[model samples]
Target: MFILTLSETECRKMLADNRLARLACAKGKQPYVVPIYYAYAGDHLYAFSLPGRKIEWMRENPLVSVLVEECGHGEEWRSVIVDGRFEELPDRIGHKRERDRAWSLLSRHADWWEPGDLKPVTPPLSKYEPEVFFRISIDRLSGRAAKAA
Candidate 1:
Protein backbone atom coordinates (compact mmCIF):
# COMPACT_ATOMS: atom_id res chain seq x y z
CA MET A 1 0.00 0.00 0.00
CA PHE A 2 1.15 3.48 -0.81
CA ILE A 3 1.56 6.04 1.95
CA LEU A 4 0.20 9.56 1.97
CA THR A 5 1.04 12.29 4.45
CA LEU A 6 -1.91 13.44 6.53
CA SER A 7 -2.79 17.01 7.40
CA GLU A 8 -2.85 18.15 11.02
CA THR A 9 -6.64 18.20 10.95
CA GLU A 10 -6.79 14.67 9.63
CA CYS A 11 -4.29 13.47 12.24
CA ARG A 12 -6.26 15.00 15.06
CA LYS A 13 -9.47 13.45 13.79
CA MET A 14 -7.97 9.98 13.88
CA LEU A 15 -6.46 10.63 17.32
CA ALA A 16 -9.87 11.63 18.65
CA ASP A 17 -11.40 8.42 17.35
CA ASN A 18 -8.78 6.10 18.83
CA ARG A 19 -7.45 5.93 22.36
CA LEU A 20 -5.25 2.83 22.51
CA ALA A 21 -1.63 3.42 21.55
CA ARG A 22 1.80 1.86 21.89
CA LEU A 23 4.14 3.77 24.14
CA ALA A 24 7.90 3.30 23.90
CA CYS A 25 10.32 4.20 26.64
CA ALA A 26 13.98 3.53 27.16
CA LYS A 27 16.03 3.28 30.31
CA GLY A 28 19.76 3.56 29.58
CA LYS A 29 20.30 0.10 28.07
CA GLN A 30 16.84 -1.40 27.85
CA PRO A 31 13.74 -0.27 25.96
CA TYR A 32 10.13 -1.08 26.72
CA VAL A 33 6.91 -0.89 24.76
CA VAL A 34 3.48 -1.05 26.29
CA PRO A 35 -0.12 -0.56 25.33
CA ILE A 36 -1.67 2.48 26.94
CA TYR A 37 -4.89 4.45 26.91
CA TYR A 38 -4.36 8.10 26.09
CA ALA A 39 -6.20 11.35 25.43
CA TYR A 40 -5.06 14.08 23.13
CA ALA A 41 -5.66 17.66 24.23
CA GLY A 42 -4.17 20.57 22.37
CA ASP A 43 -0.49 19.62 21.89
CA HIS A 44 -0.17 17.18 24.74
CA LEU A 45 -1.11 13.56 25.32
CA TYR A 46 -2.08 12.32 28.77
CA ALA A 47 -2.08 8.83 30.29
CA PHE A 48 -2.29 7.24 33.72
CA SER A 49 -0.58 4.17 35.08
CA LEU A 50 -0.51 2.38 38.37
CA PRO A 51 2.79 1.59 40.08
CA GLY A 52 3.98 -0.86 37.49
CA ARG A 53 6.31 -1.52 34.59
CA LYS A 54 5.46 1.53 32.53
CA ILE A 55 5.55 3.88 35.46
CA GLU A 56 8.90 2.58 36.56
CA TRP A 57 10.35 2.94 33.09
CA MET A 58 9.06 6.44 32.60
CA ARG A 59 10.43 7.56 35.93
CA GLU A 60 13.86 6.46 34.95
CA ASN A 61 13.73 7.85 31.42
CA PRO A 62 11.27 10.59 30.60
CA LEU A 63 11.84 10.43 26.87
CA VAL A 64 9.16 8.43 25.06
CA SER A 65 7.53 7.68 21.75
CA VAL A 66 3.97 6.71 20.87
CA LEU A 67 2.22 5.22 17.88
CA VAL A 68 -1.48 5.11 16.99
CA GLU A 69 -2.61 3.22 13.94
CA GLU A 70 -5.81 2.13 12.18
CA CYS A 71 -6.01 -0.42 9.39
CA GLY A 72 -8.75 -1.92 7.26
CA HIS A 73 -9.21 -4.08 4.19
CA GLY A 74 -7.10 -3.42 1.13
CA GLU A 75 -4.83 -0.42 1.54
CA GLU A 76 -7.02 1.66 3.82
CA TRP A 77 -5.02 2.75 6.81
CA ARG A 78 -3.83 5.68 8.90
CA SER A 79 -1.10 6.05 11.49
CA VAL A 80 0.47 8.69 13.69
CA ILE A 81 3.85 8.65 15.39
CA VAL A 82 4.74 10.96 18.26
CA ASP A 83 7.98 11.64 20.04
CA GLY A 84 8.03 13.58 23.27
CA ARG A 85 9.31 14.07 26.78
CA PHE A 86 7.08 12.85 29.61
CA GLU A 87 6.27 14.75 32.76
CA GLU A 88 4.65 13.30 35.85
CA LEU A 89 2.10 15.74 37.24
CA PRO A 90 2.78 16.52 40.86
CA ASP A 91 -0.72 17.61 41.87
CA ARG A 92 -2.89 14.67 42.85
CA ILE A 93 -6.15 16.46 42.06
CA GLY A 94 -5.09 17.44 38.59
CA HIS A 95 -3.67 13.99 37.95
CA LYS A 96 -6.96 12.33 38.79
CA ARG A 97 -8.88 14.67 36.55
CA GLU A 98 -6.60 13.99 33.63
CA ARG A 99 -6.72 10.24 34.24
CA ASP A 100 -10.51 10.28 34.14
CA ARG A 101 -10.43 12.26 30.92
CA ALA A 102 -8.10 9.74 29.35
CA TRP A 103 -10.25 6.82 30.47
CA SER A 104 -13.34 8.44 28.99
CA LEU A 105 -11.67 8.55 25.61
CA LEU A 106 -10.62 4.93 25.93
CA SER A 107 -14.13 3.85 26.89
CA ARG A 108 -15.49 5.46 23.75
CA HIS A 109 -13.24 3.49 21.40
CA ALA A 110 -12.64 0.20 23.23
CA ASP A 111 -14.56 -2.16 25.49
CA TRP A 112 -12.20 -1.67 28.41
CA TRP A 113 -15.05 0.00 30.27
CA GLU A 114 -18.38 -1.13 28.89
CA PRO A 115 -21.39 0.21 30.77
CA GLY A 116 -22.47 -3.22 32.04
CA ASP A 117 -19.18 -5.01 31.90
CA LEU A 118 -18.23 -6.96 35.01
CA LYS A 119 -15.04 -4.90 35.35
CA PRO A 120 -14.78 -2.38 38.16
CA VAL A 121 -14.95 1.21 37.07
CA THR A 122 -11.71 3.10 37.49
CA PRO A 123 -11.88 4.38 41.03
CA PRO A 124 -11.92 8.13 41.49
CA LEU A 125 -8.81 9.78 42.85
CA SER A 126 -10.33 9.97 46.32
CA LYS A 127 -10.78 6.21 46.33
CA TYR A 128 -7.77 4.81 44.48
CA GLU A 129 -5.12 7.43 43.99
CA PRO A 130 -3.18 6.53 40.90
CA GLU A 131 0.50 6.10 41.50
CA VAL A 132 1.21 8.44 38.64
CA PHE A 133 -0.44 10.48 35.93
CA PHE A 134 1.74 11.87 33.19
CA ARG A 135 1.60 14.13 30.19
CA ILE A 136 3.71 13.98 27.06
CA SER A 137 4.36 17.29 25.43
CA ILE A 138 4.84 16.33 21.85
CA ASP A 139 8.10 17.38 20.25
CA ARG A 140 7.40 15.71 16.91
CA LEU A 141 4.26 14.31 15.32
CA SER A 142 3.89 12.69 11.93
CA GLY A 143 0.96 10.95 10.30
CA ARG A 144 0.22 9.04 7.14
CA ALA A 145 -2.90 7.74 5.42
CA ALA A 146 -3.35 5.31 2.58
CA LYS A 147 -6.52 4.49 0.66
CA ALA A 148 -7.21 1.21 -1.15
CA ALA A 149 -6.22 1.27 -4.76
Candidate 2:
Protein backbone atom coordinates (compact mmCIF):
# COMPACT_ATOMS: atom_id res chain seq x y z
CA MET A 1 0.00 0.00 0.00
CA PHE A 2 0.94 3.65 0.02
CA ILE A 3 0.57 6.63 2.33
CA LEU A 4 -1.67 9.56 1.47
CA THR A 5 -1.84 13.09 2.77
CA LEU A 6 -5.08 13.90 4.54
CA SER A 7 -7.09 16.96 3.65
CA GLU A 8 -7.80 19.78 6.08
CA THR A 9 -11.23 18.33 6.82
CA GLU A 10 -9.77 14.95 7.66
CA CYS A 11 -7.11 16.50 9.84
CA ARG A 12 -9.61 18.63 11.75
CA LYS A 13 -11.89 15.65 12.25
CA MET A 14 -9.05 13.60 13.70
CA LEU A 15 -8.12 16.38 16.07
CA ALA A 16 -11.71 16.96 17.18
CA ASP A 17 -12.20 13.28 17.89
CA ASN A 18 -8.98 12.72 19.80
CA ARG A 19 -8.20 14.08 23.24
CA LEU A 20 -4.66 12.82 23.72
CA ALA A 21 -1.55 14.09 21.93
CA ARG A 22 2.13 14.75 22.31
CA LEU A 23 2.64 18.42 23.10
CA ALA A 24 6.00 19.67 21.93
CA CYS A 25 7.66 22.85 23.06
CA ALA A 26 11.12 24.30 22.98
CA LYS A 27 13.35 26.95 24.47
CA GLY A 28 16.56 28.02 22.73
CA LYS A 29 18.25 24.84 21.43
CA GLN A 30 16.40 22.43 23.70
CA PRO A 31 13.09 20.68 22.88
CA TYR A 32 10.59 18.84 25.04
CA VAL A 33 7.54 16.69 24.38
CA VAL A 34 4.97 15.33 26.77
CA PRO A 35 1.65 13.51 26.59
CA ILE A 36 -1.30 15.83 27.06
CA TYR A 37 -5.07 15.93 26.77
CA TYR A 38 -6.74 18.72 24.87
CA ALA A 39 -10.05 19.87 23.45
CA TYR A 40 -10.27 21.21 19.93
CA ALA A 41 -12.64 24.06 19.24
CA GLY A 42 -12.74 26.65 16.54
CA ASP A 43 -9.09 27.44 15.83
CA HIS A 44 -7.60 26.64 19.19
CA LEU A 45 -6.78 23.65 21.44
CA TYR A 46 -7.69 23.92 25.11
CA ALA A 47 -5.75 22.07 27.78
CA PHE A 48 -4.62 22.18 31.41
CA SER A 49 -1.36 21.35 33.13
CA LEU A 50 0.73 22.04 36.18
CA PRO A 51 3.48 24.65 36.00
CA GLY A 52 6.86 23.11 35.25
CA ARG A 53 9.46 22.79 32.55
CA LYS A 54 6.92 22.51 29.73
CA ILE A 55 5.00 25.47 31.06
CA GLU A 56 8.10 27.56 31.57
CA TRP A 57 9.44 26.71 28.14
CA MET A 58 6.16 27.59 26.46
CA ARG A 59 5.95 30.77 28.46
CA GLU A 60 9.35 31.80 27.19
CA ASN A 61 8.60 30.53 23.70
CA PRO A 62 4.97 30.29 22.65
CA LEU A 63 5.75 28.34 19.49
CA VAL A 64 4.59 24.76 19.97
CA SER A 65 3.44 21.62 18.18
CA VAL A 66 1.06 18.80 18.86
CA LEU A 67 1.17 15.27 17.48
CA VAL A 68 -1.82 12.94 17.52
CA GLU A 69 -1.83 9.46 16.04
CA GLU A 70 -3.88 6.31 15.77
CA CYS A 71 -2.35 2.95 14.90
CA GLY A 72 -4.72 0.05 14.36
CA HIS A 73 -4.00 -2.97 12.23
CA GLY A 74 -0.49 -3.90 11.18
CA GLU A 75 -0.71 -1.84 8.01
CA GLU A 76 -3.07 0.91 9.02
CA TRP A 77 -2.19 4.14 10.69
CA ARG A 78 -3.12 7.84 10.82
CA SER A 79 -1.37 10.79 12.36
CA VAL A 80 -1.72 14.55 12.55
CA ILE A 81 0.70 17.30 13.50
CA VAL A 82 -0.25 20.80 14.53
CA ASP A 83 2.00 23.82 14.79
CA GLY A 84 0.70 26.70 16.82
CA ARG A 85 1.27 29.31 19.51
CA PHE A 86 0.36 28.81 23.14
CA GLU A 87 -1.57 31.34 25.20
CA GLU A 88 -2.37 30.94 28.85
CA LEU A 89 -5.86 31.71 30.12
CA PRO A 90 -5.62 33.60 33.33
CA ASP A 91 -8.50 34.16 35.74
CA ARG A 92 -8.68 37.88 35.48
CA ILE A 93 -10.59 40.65 33.81
CA GLY A 94 -10.73 40.87 30.00
CA HIS A 95 -9.76 37.18 29.63
CA LYS A 96 -12.72 35.74 31.48
CA ARG A 97 -14.76 34.93 28.43
CA GLU A 98 -12.06 32.99 26.62
CA ARG A 99 -11.11 31.18 29.78
CA ASP A 100 -14.72 30.13 30.31
CA ARG A 101 -14.97 28.96 26.73
CA ALA A 102 -11.83 26.89 27.12
CA TRP A 103 -13.27 25.30 30.23
CA SER A 104 -16.55 24.53 28.45
CA LEU A 105 -14.81 22.79 25.59
CA LEU A 106 -12.63 20.62 27.85
CA SER A 107 -15.40 19.79 30.31
CA ARG A 108 -17.01 17.48 27.75
CA HIS A 109 -14.67 14.69 28.80
CA ALA A 110 -15.59 12.85 32.00
CA ASP A 111 -12.02 12.88 33.20
CA TRP A 112 -10.95 16.08 31.54
CA TRP A 113 -9.17 17.39 34.62
CA GLU A 114 -6.78 14.62 35.39
CA PRO A 115 -3.03 14.29 36.01
CA GLY A 116 -3.26 18.06 36.13
CA ASP A 117 -5.44 17.73 39.16
CA LEU A 118 -3.62 14.77 40.69
CA LYS A 119 -1.45 15.72 43.61
CA PRO A 120 2.27 15.25 43.35
CA VAL A 121 3.44 11.94 44.83
CA THR A 122 6.94 12.66 46.11
CA PRO A 123 6.55 16.36 46.78
CA PRO A 124 3.55 18.59 46.38
CA LEU A 125 4.69 20.69 43.47
CA SER A 126 5.19 24.30 44.44
CA LYS A 127 4.51 25.24 40.86
CA TYR A 128 0.98 23.84 40.93
CA GLU A 129 -1.23 26.69 41.84
CA PRO A 130 -4.49 28.50 41.04
CA GLU A 131 -6.09 27.76 37.70
CA VAL A 132 -4.07 26.43 34.78
CA PHE A 133 -5.93 26.82 31.49
CA PHE A 134 -4.51 27.57 28.08
CA ARG A 135 -5.11 27.34 24.36
CA ILE A 136 -2.96 26.71 21.33
CA SER A 137 -3.88 28.83 18.35
CA ILE A 138 -3.39 26.62 15.33
CA ASP A 139 -1.23 28.13 12.64
CA ARG A 140 -0.70 25.02 10.52
CA LEU A 141 -1.89 21.43 10.66
CA SER A 142 -1.20 18.39 8.52
CA GLY A 143 -1.96 14.68 8.57
CA ARG A 144 -1.14 11.41 6.81
CA ALA A 145 -2.63 7.96 6.63
CA ALA A 146 -1.82 4.54 5.29
CA LYS A 147 -3.66 1.28 4.83
CA ALA A 148 -2.88 -2.14 3.45
CA ALA A 149 -3.66 -2.64 -0.17
Candidate 3:
Protein backbone atom coordinates (compact mmCIF):
# COMPACT_ATOMS: atom_id res chain seq x y z
CA MET A 1 0.00 0.00 0.00
CA PHE A 2 1.06 3.53 -0.58
CA ILE A 3 0.31 6.59 1.54
CA LEU A 4 0.26 9.95 -0.19
CA THR A 5 -0.42 13.54 0.71
CA LEU A 6 -3.54 15.15 -0.71
CA SER A 7 -3.44 18.53 -2.40
CA GLU A 8 -5.41 21.54 -1.16
CA THR A 9 -8.06 20.98 -3.80
CA GLU A 10 -8.43 17.35 -2.79
CA CYS A 11 -8.71 18.33 0.84
CA ARG A 12 -11.39 20.91 0.10
CA LYS A 13 -13.26 18.40 -2.05
CA MET A 14 -13.23 15.94 0.80
CA LEU A 15 -14.59 18.58 3.09
CA ALA A 16 -17.34 19.44 0.62
CA ASP A 17 -18.28 15.82 0.07
CA ASN A 18 -18.46 14.93 3.76
CA ARG A 19 -20.81 16.28 6.42
CA LEU A 20 -19.68 14.58 9.60
CA ALA A 21 -16.42 15.49 11.28
CA ARG A 22 -14.68 15.28 14.62
CA LEU A 23 -14.46 18.74 16.18
CA ALA A 24 -11.77 19.34 18.77
CA CYS A 25 -11.49 22.25 21.17
CA ALA A 26 -9.51 23.12 24.27
CA LYS A 27 -10.15 24.99 27.49
CA GLY A 28 -7.06 25.92 29.44
CA LYS A 29 -5.21 22.57 29.53
CA GLN A 30 -8.18 20.31 28.95
CA PRO A 31 -9.07 19.18 25.42
CA TYR A 32 -12.43 17.93 24.20
CA VAL A 33 -13.53 16.35 20.93
CA VAL A 34 -16.94 15.47 19.51
CA PRO A 35 -18.56 14.31 16.32
CA ILE A 36 -20.42 17.10 14.51
CA TYR A 37 -22.19 17.64 11.18
CA TYR A 38 -21.16 20.61 9.10
CA ALA A 39 -21.57 22.37 5.75
CA TYR A 40 -18.56 23.52 3.79
CA ALA A 41 -18.88 26.86 2.02
CA GLY A 42 -16.31 29.43 1.08
CA ASP A 43 -13.56 29.02 3.69
CA HIS A 44 -15.68 27.95 6.61
CA LEU A 45 -17.36 24.85 7.98
CA TYR A 46 -20.79 25.78 9.29
CA ALA A 47 -22.42 23.72 12.03
CA PHE A 48 -25.20 23.71 14.57
CA SER A 49 -25.45 22.50 18.14
CA LEU A 50 -27.17 23.08 21.46
CA PRO A 51 -25.79 24.72 24.53
CA GLY A 52 -23.44 22.13 26.00
CA ARG A 53 -19.97 21.58 27.31
CA LYS A 54 -18.43 21.74 23.83
CA ILE A 55 -20.24 24.96 23.07
CA GLU A 56 -19.20 26.60 26.32
CA TRP A 57 -15.61 25.53 25.91
CA MET A 58 -15.48 26.74 22.33
CA ARG A 59 -16.92 30.10 23.31
CA GLU A 60 -14.08 30.48 25.73
CA ASN A 61 -11.52 29.31 23.19
CA PRO A 62 -12.33 29.81 19.55
CA LEU A 63 -9.33 27.87 18.31
CA VAL A 64 -10.51 24.52 17.03
CA SER A 65 -9.72 21.61 14.73
CA VAL A 66 -11.84 19.26 12.67
CA LEU A 67 -11.11 15.85 11.21
CA VAL A 68 -13.02 14.26 8.32
CA GLU A 69 -12.30 10.74 7.21
CA GLU A 70 -13.45 8.27 4.58
CA CYS A 71 -12.72 4.55 4.78
CA GLY A 72 -13.17 2.12 1.92
CA HIS A 73 -12.80 -1.61 1.42
CA GLY A 74 -9.61 -3.30 2.59
CA GLU A 75 -6.84 -0.73 3.03
CA GLU A 76 -8.25 2.27 1.24
CA TRP A 77 -8.78 5.37 3.32
CA ARG A 78 -8.66 9.16 3.22
CA SER A 79 -8.54 11.71 6.02
CA VAL A 80 -8.52 15.50 6.23
CA ILE A 81 -7.72 17.78 9.11
CA VAL A 82 -8.73 21.42 9.45
CA ASP A 83 -7.27 24.01 11.76
CA GLY A 84 -9.77 26.81 12.27
CA ARG A 85 -11.37 29.54 14.37
CA PHE A 86 -14.93 29.50 15.60
CA GLU A 87 -17.51 32.22 15.07
CA GLU A 88 -21.02 32.17 16.41
CA LEU A 89 -24.08 33.23 14.42
CA PRO A 90 -26.58 34.30 17.01
CA ASP A 91 -30.26 34.99 16.39
CA ARG A 92 -30.05 38.73 16.62
CA ILE A 93 -30.37 41.74 14.40
CA GLY A 94 -26.67 41.96 13.68
CA HIS A 95 -26.35 38.31 12.70
CA LYS A 96 -29.68 37.71 10.96
CA ARG A 97 -28.13 37.29 7.54
CA GLU A 98 -25.43 34.97 8.74
CA ARG A 99 -27.90 32.92 10.74
CA ASP A 100 -30.13 32.57 7.71
CA ARG A 101 -27.24 31.51 5.56
CA ALA A 102 -26.21 28.91 8.10
CA TRP A 103 -29.73 27.58 8.29
CA SER A 104 -29.96 27.33 4.53
CA LEU A 105 -26.68 25.46 4.29
CA LEU A 106 -27.52 23.05 7.10
CA SER A 107 -31.02 22.34 5.83
CA ARG A 108 -29.81 20.85 2.54
CA HIS A 109 -29.29 17.45 4.14
CA ALA A 110 -32.08 15.21 5.41
CA ASP A 111 -32.72 15.33 9.15
CA TRP A 112 -30.16 18.11 9.43
CA TRP A 113 -31.61 19.19 12.77
CA GLU A 114 -30.83 15.87 14.33
CA PRO A 115 -28.24 15.26 17.07
CA GLY A 116 -27.79 19.01 17.25
CA ASP A 117 -31.38 19.69 18.16
CA LEU A 118 -32.11 16.44 19.98
CA LYS A 119 -32.46 16.85 23.70
CA PRO A 120 -30.17 14.82 25.87
CA VAL A 121 -31.57 11.40 26.86
CA THR A 122 -30.70 12.29 30.45
CA PRO A 123 -30.76 15.95 31.21
CA PRO A 124 -27.42 17.19 32.36
CA LEU A 125 -28.80 20.05 34.47
CA SER A 126 -32.44 20.26 33.52
CA LYS A 127 -31.85 23.62 31.92
CA TYR A 128 -33.12 24.86 28.60
CA GLU A 129 -30.65 24.35 25.80
CA PRO A 130 -30.88 26.79 22.96
CA GLU A 131 -29.79 25.96 19.46
CA VAL A 132 -26.49 27.45 18.34
CA PHE A 133 -25.24 28.19 14.84
CA PHE A 134 -21.57 28.61 14.28
CA ARG A 135 -18.84 28.34 11.69
CA ILE A 136 -15.24 27.25 11.74
CA SER A 137 -13.12 29.52 9.61
CA ILE A 138 -10.49 27.21 8.20
CA ASP A 139 -6.96 28.45 8.63
CA ARG A 140 -5.20 25.38 7.30
CA LEU A 141 -6.24 22.12 5.71
CA SER A 142 -4.23 18.95 5.25
CA GLY A 143 -5.09 15.46 4.17
CA ARG A 144 -3.69 12.00 3.52
CA ALA A 145 -4.82 9.07 1.42
CA ALA A 146 -3.86 5.45 1.44
CA LYS A 147 -4.39 3.00 -1.42
CA ALA A 148 -3.21 -0.47 -2.42
CA ALA A 149 -0.08 -0.53 -4.56
**Which one is best on TM-score?**
3
| Candidate 3 accuracy as TM-score | 0.93
What residue runs in model 3 are displaced by over 4 Å at the alpha carbon?
123-127
Per-candidate clashes come to: 0, 0, 0
Q: Write the per-residue lDDT of candidate 1 for residues 1-149, one digit (tens) a residue.
A: 67799887887777777778899998888889878777788788877666566677888888999999998777698899889989886556756666666556444555543221222446633455444557788888889988765
For 1-149, candidate 2 gives per-residue lDDT tens digits of: 78999999999999998999999999999999988889999899999886677889999999999999999699899999999999999899988999999889989999898756665468656553775899999999999999788
Q: Model 3, residue 146: displacement in angstroms?
A: 0.8
| Model 1 poorest 10 in a row by lDDT | 112-121
lDDT for model 1, please.
Answer: 0.74
The TM-score, computed over Cα atoms with residue i paired to residue i, of candidate 1 is 0.73
lDDT over C-alpha atoms for residue 103 of model 3: 95
Q: The CA-based lDDT of model 2 is what?
A: 0.90
TM-score of each: 0.73, 0.93, 0.93
Model 1 residue 63 CA deviation (Å) reads 1.0
Candidate 2 deviant stretches above 4 angstroms: 126-128
